[model samples]
Target chain A: MDKTYPSIEEAIVDVPDGAVIAIPGFFAAGVPRILLQALIKKGVKELTLACGCGPLLGATEELTQLVKNRQLKKVIDSYGLFRSATKGLQDPFEQAVRAGEIELEVYPMGTLAEKYRAAGAGIPAFYTPTGVGSIVEKNTVTNIVENRKPKETKVFDGEKYVLEYALKTDYAFIHAYMGDKEGNLVYRKTSRNFNHVMATAGKITIAEVENLMEPGEIDPDCVHTSGIYVQRVLKVPRIGFAITID
Target chain B: MAKKFEGLPREMIAMRASKEIKDGDYVNLGIGIPTLVSNWIEGKDVILQSEIGMTKTGPLAFNDDIDQDLINASCQPVTELPGIAYFDIFDSFSMIRGGYMDVIIMGALQVNGRGDYAGWANPAARGLDIGNIGGSMDLCAGATKLFLTMTHTAPDGAPKIVNEISFPLTVKGKVNMVFTDLAVIEITSEGPVLKEVYPGLTPEDIQSVTEPKLIIAPDLKEIEL
Candidate 1:
C-alpha cells in the first residue's frame, strides 16, 4: 500500500466509461476539481454522478460542461435544480433533464448523506421519516436500490417511514486538506461535508490533497478519513503553483 | 422590497422572530429574513446550527474575516463560536432527524390554512422539477417546532396566505408560527389566527390578502416591534 499517484490522469485512468461516481463537495469547497478535469479530458461517456448537490456551481466548469456535452446519463443528488425562483435562467443540466437527455433522482438532504453512509457500512436499507407525507415519499423512484429491490413504506409506532436504499458507487473523487502516502486524509472546516462519507461509499476512493505530510506528521486525533478506506491519494500542486494539464 | 406592505420593516420582522426563540435553543436559520434573526438575538443564549455540519456557528463573517472553507448552508461565510464543532453530513443530519434541533426558522413561498407551507419549488416555473428542497423536509419533520419568515404577498400582488398552496409543498402542518411583513399569525387547529397587525394596516387590509379564515385575536393590537 503505498497508494500515492503521480498525476490526476494516472489516478483516474482506470475509471472506465459508464461508471457510477460519487464526487464529494458542497458548493465551492473541498471538491476534487483536478480529478473532474481529468475525467473531462478523458471524455468518458454515459456516467452516473452522485453528489450532495447536483451539478455544483461556483466550482469548475468541467462537470457542468460535461453535462452540457451530453456525457452524464444520470444524476443522483439532493439539490438538483437551482434554488432560486427567478425564471428564465439557463442551466444546461436542467435543460437536458427537461429534454429527456438526463435522468434525475433527488433525495432529502439528510437521506442523501445517510444512504451513502449506510452503503459504506454494508447496510441494505434503512427507514427514515424525513419525507412522510410529502411528494418525496409519494413519487420517489425505487429502481435505484441495489438488486432492483422494491422499496417498502412502513409505519413505525405511528410515524411514516420510507425505506431508502444504501448508495454505492464505482469511484469516489474527493479533496482533502492533507494526506499521507499511506492514505490517511484530513479535511478543512465545513469542506468536510460529504468527503468523509463518500470516502467510504466508493469501491475505489481517490483523494486529491493540498498537502502531503509524513506518516507521523498529523495528530492521530485529527484524521478525518482513515488510510484503510482510501485507495489512492494525489498530492496536488500547492496553492498558487499553476498546474498544467495536458 | 414590495413597497414594504404598509407594515413592519424587515428589521422589525426579524426582531419579532427573535422574541419567539428561547434561550439555549438549537436553531436552524434559513435564508432571507430568518438569517436576520441571528443579528437581533446578539446577546441571547442560542446555539445556531447549520445543516452543512457546524454547530454553535457565530454571526456572518466580514469580507476580510471570510473563509471560503467555512460557510453555512446558505453558502455564506460564517465565524465559529467558542464551542464550534464540525461533523460530516451524516452526523449533522442525524442531529436533525433525531429530533435534537429545537427550532427552525425558514422562509416561505406559500402557507395554507392547515399550517402546511410551500417553500422549495415553484410549480409555475419548473413544474415539479427537482428544485431545492435543501433541509426543509427534515427540519419540518424532526425539529421540535417550526417558524416561518415571509412577506405577506407574492411579488405579483397575489396573496401568499392562501386557502391552498399552488406550489409544491415542502412540509405539511408543521408550522407553529409565521412572521410576515403585515401581521404575525399563529397556526392553530382551527386555522391561522391573526395575533397582531402592523400599525398602518387594519384587520381588513390583512384579511383582504389572506384567503384562510382569519380569526382576529380578541384584543388585536399593533405589533410591538
Candidate 2:
C-alpha cells in the first residue's frame, strides 16, 4: 500500500487541536520544516509539543512560530531554554513559559529517549538511574492533562533508579533523508536523533522526506525506521539549516 | 571580561583532560571546554561519540565537507570518520546509560567537595529558572569515568570548587577527575586531592582560589602537557 501524500498540508491535515504531537529533531537537524509550516497554516490550538529542543534558538523558526501563534499549551522537552544574546530575541517558547501562557516539563535526554522507546516497544514503564537525585525526581505534581506523578525509586544491586512511564503521543512528525512509498525511512548521520523512536511511539506517524523512492529502493539493511511505524509520507525540498557555532 | 586570576588557558585544560583518555577508549565530550578535547585526541585510538547518535565523529566540518545532518551535540556541523556508526537516540542513550562509555568529559558550573557537580541549571539567567539538561545527567551518571573541565573559578572570581554546589546538581558523587585552569584535581575517597598545578603556581595559590580546602598530593608536580 502506498503511503505517499500529494502535499505536506494533506499529510498533516488530520492533526486535531489539543493533540500531543512529537516532533523529533536535535537543534536544527532533521526537522520537518514543510510539515511544520503546514502545521502553522492549519492553526491547530492547544498543541502539546514533545520535542528535543523547547523552541530551538536560532534554529528552526517554525516551532518558535507555533509558540508565538499561541498554539502550544505545554512542552515536554529535554533542552529547555537556549539563551539568546540579544534581549528581545529570546525564544518565544521561553517567553510564553515565563508569561505563564504555556507549561514546561523537562527531563534528562536519555530518560526522554527511553520513554519514547518504551512506548514504541509496548513497555509501560521502566527504571533508570539518570535522574534519581535531581529536580526531575522532585517535580512530580499531578496535572489535569497528563497525570504527572511523583517518580517511584527502587534499588537494584545496591544502585538507585527512578521509575519513568512511557510517553505516547497522538502523532509523530518526522523528517527523513529518504522515504519509500511503503513508508520505510532512512535517516542521515546525527539527524537520526529522536525520529526513529518517536515514529513508533505515535498513534499515527507522518514523515516528510527529502527524497521519495520506490519500496525496494532503500535496502532492508539500511532502513532506520521500518515502514510499519509510518502512516503518511510527503516529499519536500531539502532545507539547509545547521547551526554553526565557532 | 578578563579573568582576575591567570592560569592555564582553556585549551590547556582540555589538553590535560585529554591525557586521561587511554587508547581504544570511547569518549563523549560535552559542550564548551570539554568539546575542545576532541582537537587534542586526533589520530589517537580514542573514539569520540556524540550523544545525538554518532560514534567515531571527526573534527568540526568546515567548508565543502559540512553536512547539515552530521553534527555534534553542540549542533555544529561535523565530519564522519571511517568505521562511523549511527543509530537512533534510544540506542545512543542506551550506550550511555548502559555503562558502555569509557570516559565523558563535561563542563560544570560548580563542583562541591563531595564530587557533586552542577552543570545544567543556571539560576542566574534573567527570569529563566531552568537551563538545558541535554545529555549531561546521563553521561555523568552512566559513563565509566567523568572528567570535568572548567575554570577553577567563576567569572566573578568566586571559587567554583566550593564547599557546596549552589546550582542544581547534574549528579552527586560522580566526578572522577577535574581539570581546571589552575590545577588538575582528583576526587578521591579522602577528598579532592591536588595532583598538579599550573607551572610556577603553588598549592597555596590554588587553595586560595578554591572554596574547599584541598589535600595536597605528596607527589604534586607542575601540570605536564
Candidate 3:
C-alpha cells in the first residue's frame, strides 16, 4: 500500500510508449474512466490494450483519440468497443488504419485476460482448444495438450494442438473500492477482474478508488488486493457518478 | 412446417424469430443480426443477454438519458427489465461456460459445413469493429443450442455458408441451425440439412444462390410470405 498521489494524473507517471496495458472494465463497469482521461493528458502511445471488452478510460482513450486524429501510432485491442462522442469505433480506427496511424489486433476476451494473468504470473502461454480448426486459429501459435500417451495421437499426448498467444503488459489500470493513504486497495465484487493480476503484470500500476479510508479500516478477510502492486491512487466518487451510470 | 426467409430485412428476420424464444430461457445474442432480436422479442418475459454482461438488454439508446452503468457483458448500453440482477463477469461467463444458456443467436461472417463460425470483429467488412469475446467463446462452448441469422449472400453474391469457412473462426462445430434470407438450414452430422426455403424461391433458385452443396429435407417447407 503506497497511496499518496493527490490526483489521478499523478499516478500515470512512469508509463512509457508502446506499453501493453490491461484495464478492468467489461463493457463499462469498473473502468477507470477519469484516470484514463488523465492518462490521455499524460500522453503515452503505441498501446497494446487488453481488457474484458472495449473502450479505454485514461490516457489510453486520449491516445486512441490521438490515433483516430492521426497524432498517434498503433493500438492492439481484442474488442472494438471504443466509443468517441466525436467519432464512433469504426471511423477513427478505420481512418487510422488507412492512414497507417495504427494497427489493431482483435482478440477473444477470456484469452486476453488469461494471457495477462499468465504473463503477470510469468508463464509464457498455454494451449486452448477454443479456436481449433477455424480461421481464428490462423497464425496463432500452437500448444499441445498432454493427457494420454503421446503415441496415441502421434502428436504429444492424446490431446490435440490448439493455438495460444502470450500477453504481456507495460501497465495495468485498475479500479478500487477503497484505498488507504498508503495505496492498499480493496475491490468491489464483480466490478473487479484482471485489475489485480494486471497490476502486477505491468511495469507500472495505477489505481483509482472511490473512497480513501484509513489503513486499519480494511478488514483482513475482505481485502482482495494487497497494496504492494498498486503504485499510486486517486480517490473518486463511489461508482455513483464520474463512472458509467447505466 | 417451418418457414424460409421472405425477402425481409436481415434485422426483421432476426426480430421475427424472437417470437419463438420462450420465457425463462437463458439466451445469448451474438453481435450483428442477433443484437436486433432484442427489439422484436419484447414481452412480459424473454430475458435478453449480450455477451458483455446485462440480461434483459433493451435497444441501444437514442438519447443521453441512457444509463452507461447498465450494459451487457459486451459493454453496450442497454435497458433492463424488472428482476435484472448483477454478478461477477466471470460468474456469468462461467454460466455460459457451464452449459447454462438455453439459446444463442449471432450473426456470422462465415459458417462452414462443419458449423464453424466467424463473428469476431472484422475490420475488413464494414469498417466497424464492435465485438469482443467476453463470454461468447464460452457461450459457444457451453450453450444448450444455437441459432444463426444472416442473409443468403454477400453484397458481391459470394456465399457466406459454404463447404468450408474462408474467414477466421470463432468456434468450431458449434452451430445448430442457420437462418439466412433464402432459407433455414439445420446443421447435421451429415452436413447442412435444408429445413426450408423462403417463399417464392424454388430449390433451383436457392441452388443458384448458394455456392455450397445442399440437401432438401423430406418435408422441406416454404418460408413465410
Candidate 4:
C-alpha cells in the first residue's frame, strides 16, 4: 500500500514538463480542480491536454489562460469553455492562433476519444463517423478512407472517411469519490464521466479523491479505475453538483 | 382556461393549454414561446427536461454566479434539481431517441396542413444552418405528444401556419396542436380545427390570422384572458 498525499502536487510530483496530459471530468462535473491547480502552479509549458469537452468539464477557462499567457503551446479540442468570453475561443491563446503563435487543432469528440484509445492500445489511427462532410476533417494531411458509401453517390463528394491520429499522453488527472492508498478510484452519481478512460490513456495517472477509503472498501462492481493504472492519489475537497446514489 | 400572464406574446396564450400536463409527466420545452411554459407552470409538478441536460432549468443567472458550468439548451446557465441525472450528450440523446419523452412543446416557424414542423432557430438564413441541432431531431421523432406555439405569420406578414410550408422541416406531421395569440388550433389527420379563441378575438379574427382553412370544433369557446 502507498501513502496517500494531502495535495495533488505531491501526487504528481514526478510529472515532466511538455508531457501530454489526459484530463478527466465532463463539462465541469468531474474536474479535479486542485489537481489542475497543482499542474498549473508547476508552470509546465508546451504540453498537450487531452479530454472530452474540458471547457464544459471545468478546465477550459484555466487552460485557455495558460495558453494565452504562453504557458502552453497548443490544444487538441472541439470547442471552448466560454460562449461569450473572448474574441474567438474565449481565450488569449486563440488570439495567438490568429497571430500564428500556436496551432489550435479541433477534434470532433468521437475522433478525439478514438485517437486516444488507439494510442493507449498501441494502434496508429482509427476511423470514425463523427466528421464526414463537416469542417472537422480538413486543413492538413492524413485521409483514412471508410469502406462504406454515401446514401447518394456522386463525383466531388470527397470521401465519407475520418483519419484520427493517435492521442498519446504522459499524465492523467481525475477527481474520484473514493480512493485507497494504492490509488483505486470510485465515482458517485454523474461524477463517472471520462475519468476512467482518461486514467488508462496516460503513462502516469494522478487521482484526487474526495474521500480516502481502505483497499477493497469500495464495492468491486462500482470501482471504475483500478490501482494498477493509477500511480498517485491525493485527498481533496467536495464541492458542487453532487448527488449520492448510494 | 387560465389568466394570461401580461406582457407574454399573443402566441403564448394559445399554447397555455398545457392544463393537460398531469403530475409526473416528462415534458421537453422547445425554444420560443414554448420556453415560457416553464414560467407559466405554477401548480403542476411536471418534470421539465431540457435538451441541453438540465431538468426544470431556471432562468438566466444574475451575476458571474453564472456557473460558466451548468446551462440550458439556449446556452444559458441554470439550476440543478435533486432528481436530475446528468449524462453524456450521446446517452442523453438516446433517451430522446428512445421515445422516453412524454410531451414536447416547440415553437414552429412553419406548420403545414400536414402539421409538419420547421422552426430550427435563427431562421433568417437561407441555408440550413443553426448553432447546433441539440436534440430537436430526436425530440420531434420521440415525443408522444407535440405542441406548437407561435405567431400567426412571419415577420413579413406572410402566414407561417398554412397549407404548404416553404422552409426545411425538422419533423413531419409531429404537431398535434398549434397555438397563436388569436386562437388555439388542433391538427387532426383530416385537417386543422379551431379549438379555442382568446378574449376580444373572434373566430373570424382567428380565421384572418390563420392561413389554413379553420374548422370550428363543436365545443369551440373563448379563451381565458
Candidate 5:
C-alpha cells in the first residue's frame, strides 16, 4: 500500500492530545521540523515527549516552539536539563520543571535507547550495569515523576543491575534522508542517531523524508529502518543541510 | 620571541591528558576541557568515540566545514576521519559497558583519594533529583581506565582533590589519574601521589590546596610542556 501523505499537517493530523510521542533527534540533527511545526499548528496538548533532551539550544525554531508554547506535559530523557555553554541561558525544559509545569524522568542515555529497542523487539525488560552503585541507582525512584512505573533491581553473577522496562510510545515522529512509497527509509551519517530505534518503538511510526521515491529507489542494503515499522510517510522539501538523494 | 608560561592553561591540562592516551587507543572524550585533548594529540591513530554514535571522529568542524547532521556527544558539529563508523546509541553504550574503550577523559568537580569521583552534580538542594548525569556513570563503569581533567580549585579557590567528595558520586574507584591545572596525580592503592607539578609550583604548594595529604613521587618532575 502507498504510505505517502500529501502534507506534513495531514501526516500528523490524527495525533491526539496526551499522546506519548517519541521524537527522533539529537540536539538539532535529524529533527522532523515540518512535522513538529504541524503538531504546533494542531495545538495538541499534554504531550508526553519520549526522546532525547527537549529542544536543545540552536534546535530548529519549530521544535523549540513546542517547549516555548508549553505544549509538553512530561519529558523522558537523559539530558533534559542540558543548556549549551554557548546558549547562555537555563534550559527551557529545566525551567519548566522548576516551575512545576513539566514532569521530568531522566534516564541514562543508553538505558533510554535500549528501552525503545526492547519495546520494538517485544522484550519486556532488560538489566544493565550502567548505573549499578551510583546515585542513578540510589535515586532511581525519586527521579521519576509521580512514580509512574516501578523498577526492579536484581543481582546476577554477583554483579548488580537495574531493570529498565521497554518503552512504547503512542506515536513516533521521524525524519530521514530518503524513503520510498512503501515506507522503507535511510538516514544520513550521525543524523541516524535515535531515529532508527524510535521508529520501531512507536505504535504508529510516521516518517518525513527529504527525498521520497518509488519502491526500490533506496537500495535494500542501505535501508536503516525498514518499512514494516513505518506506517506513514510524507516528503518534505530538503532544507539547510546538504543531503543528496540517491 | 620565547614564550613564558605562567600558569597551566586549559590547553596544558589537555596536553597532559593527551599524554595518557597512547597511539591506536579507542578513547572517549567528555565535554569541556577534556574535549580539547583532540587538538593536542597528533595524527589519526587514536580513535575517538562519542555517545551519540560515532567512532574515529576528527577535529571540530568550523563555519563552512560544519555539517549540522554530524555532531559529537557535546552536540558540536564535527568532521569524520576515514574509516569512521556509525551505530545506534545501544551499540555505542555496548562498546562502553562492554569494556571496549581503552580510556575515558572527563572533567570532574571532585575526586577523593580512593579514585572515586563526583562530577555530574553538586551536593545541594535535591541536586540528584534534577542533575543531568548523562553518560558519566556509564563511562565510569565501563572504561578500562578513567582520567579526570579539571582545574585544581573551584573559582572560589576551594580544593577539588579532597579526602571525600561533597558532590554526589558519579562512580567510585574509577579515576586512575587526574590531569589538573596544577599537577598530574596518580591514584594508587595507597591513595593520591603527586607525580608531576607545573613549573614554579612546589609539592608543598599542591599539598596546601589539596584537602587530602599527598605523597610526592620519587620521580616527580616539573610539567614538561
Candidate 6:
C-alpha cells in the first residue's frame, strides 16, 4: 500500500517518449522542480506537455530546458509567452514555435483547468461561454493536434457557448507541501492551482512532496488530494522561495 | 511616430477605476494597471480574488512574508489576509465563470465603440501570433461588471479607443467602463460617453487621441481624485 519511491528518477522511470504529461503549477509557485529536472536528466523527447505557463521569462527553468532541448513536440497551455515588459530578452519556446520546431495550443485559463477537471470527473465535453467571438473560437479550426480537435459550438437559451473536450494525460506531475505514505497530499495557499484536478486526470499521478509523512499523519479532513488518485510519491528537499520546511 | 499626449499618470487611472468598486464587493484585478487597483482599496470592504486560486489576498508580500507558494495571478509573491481561502484552478474559475465576481478590472490593448475589447494579444507584438488568454475571457463573460484600465493610446501614440477593434477580440461587447490616462468613459447604448477628463483637457482634447467619436456627458468634469 506504500506509494513512496526512493528517488525522483525511479518515480518517473516509466515515462516514455511521446507521452502526454500534465505539469501543474502557476509560474514557479507549485511546480515539481526536481521531478522536471529528472525528466531533463532522463532525456525523454517529443513530450506532449500540458502546463499552465510556457517558458515564462525564465520563471520555470526546468520546463524551459525541456523546450530548449527540443524535447517537446507540442505544448497545451494557457500562457504561451511571458508578454515581457522588458525588451531584448528572448524566449526559446517562442523561438521554437516561430521556427516550426514545435506546435502550440493556447486556451483560456479557465477552459484549460475545466478540461482537466472534466477528464478527472469522467465528463467527455462541456459547453462554456468563454470564447464566443475570439481567436480562441478560431483555434478549433487552426489546431491540428490530436485529441485537440476542432471544437463544437452550440446555443442554449439564446446564449452561445463553445464545446471543449476533456484533457486526459498519460502522466500528471505535481508538487506538494506535504504528503503521506498513502499519497494523500496537502498543498499550500495559491500553490494548489491546477494540482488538485490534474491529480485525477492523469493515468498515473506522481507527486513530489517537501515533507513525507506516515499515512495517518495528515488529518482525514485536511487532505487536498486523496491518496487514491496518486500512484507514486517522492520526497524532495524544498529549494526555491521562502518558508521554513518545518 | 504619432503625436503623444500627456495625460494622467498610471496610478491616477487606477485610482479613478477603483471608484467603480463598491464596499463589500468581490473584485478581480487583471495584470498591469488594474493590478494597481489593489493599492487603492486597501482598507475597503472589497475582497481581491486572484485567478491562480486565492481570495481575500493582501498586498504584495515583502521580505519576511514572502512565500513562493502564495502568489497572485501575476505570479508576484503576495501576502495572505485574514479569512483567506485557497481553492484549485477549476473552482477559482468557477467563481469567476459562475458569476460570483461583482467586478473585474482588466487591462486592454484595444476597445471599440461597442465596448468590445481585445487585450490578450496584439498582432503587433513580436512572437505573439498566439497570445496569453489566461482567465480574461471567463472574467469578461462572468463578472457582473467589467472595467478596463489602460493608457489612452498605445506607446507609439496610436488610438486604442477605436471605432472597431483591429486586434483579436478577448470578449465581445463586455466592457462596462474604461479608465484611461486621458479620461474616464462609460460604454452606453448611445456610445462611449466621456464622464471625466484630466485637468485642463477638454472632451475635444480626449477625442483627438481616440478614434471613435465620443459623447460628452452633461456632467463631464475634470477628474477628481
A74-114 per-residue lDDT for model 3 (tens digits): 44445544433234434545555544345555455556655
DockQ metric for all predictions: 0.53, 0.62, 0.27, 0.10, 0.47, 0.63
Ranking by TM-score: 6, 2, 1, 5, 3, 4
lDDT of predicted model 6 = 0.84
Task: Report lDDT (Cα) of residue B25, candidate 1.
Answer: 92
lDDT of each candidate versus the true structure: 0.81, 0.83, 0.62, 0.62, 0.80, 0.84
The most accurate candidate by DockQ is 6
RMSD of each predicted structure: 3.8, 2.3, 6.4, 8.6, 4.2, 2.8
- The clash tally of candidate 5 reads 0
What are the per-residue Cα lDDT tens digits for candidate 1 across A1-246?
A: 688998888899999889999988776666777788888888999998898854255353665778866779887777766655343146676667666677767778888898899999999799998877677777663223332233468988987798888999999998899999889999999889999999999999999999998899889899999998899999986442111110
In the range A101-143, model 2's lDDT, one tens digit per residue, is: 7877778889989889999999999989997677767665212
Question: How close is every model to the real structure, measured as TM-score?
Answer: 0.93, 0.95, 0.76, 0.57, 0.92, 0.95
Per-residue C-alpha lDDT of model 4 across residues B15-37, encoded as one tens digit per residue: 36576567888888865577767
Colliding pairs, model 5: none
Q: What is the lDDT, from 0 to 100, of the residue B57 in candidate 2?
A: 88
- DockQ, cand. 3: 0.27
Q: Give the TM-score of candidate 5.
A: 0.92
> Any runs in candidate 4 off by more than 4 Å, and if so which?
A1-29, A32-60, A63-173, A181-206, A216-233, A237-246, B1-17, B30-93, B106-130, B148-175, B178-194, B202-225
Task: Tell me the spans in candidate 1 whose CA falls farther than 4 Å from its real position.
Answer: A85-88, A141-151, A238-246, B1-5
Off by over 4 Å in 2: A53-55, A83-89, A141-149, A242-246, B1-4
The TM-score measured for candidate 1 stands at: 0.93
DockQ score, prediction 5: 0.47
Model 4 chain A poorest 10 in a row by lDDT: A140-149
Q: List the residue pairs that clash in candidate 2.
A: none
Task: Provide all candidates' interface root-mean-square deviations.
Answer: 5.2, 2.9, 5.5, 8.7, 5.1, 4.1
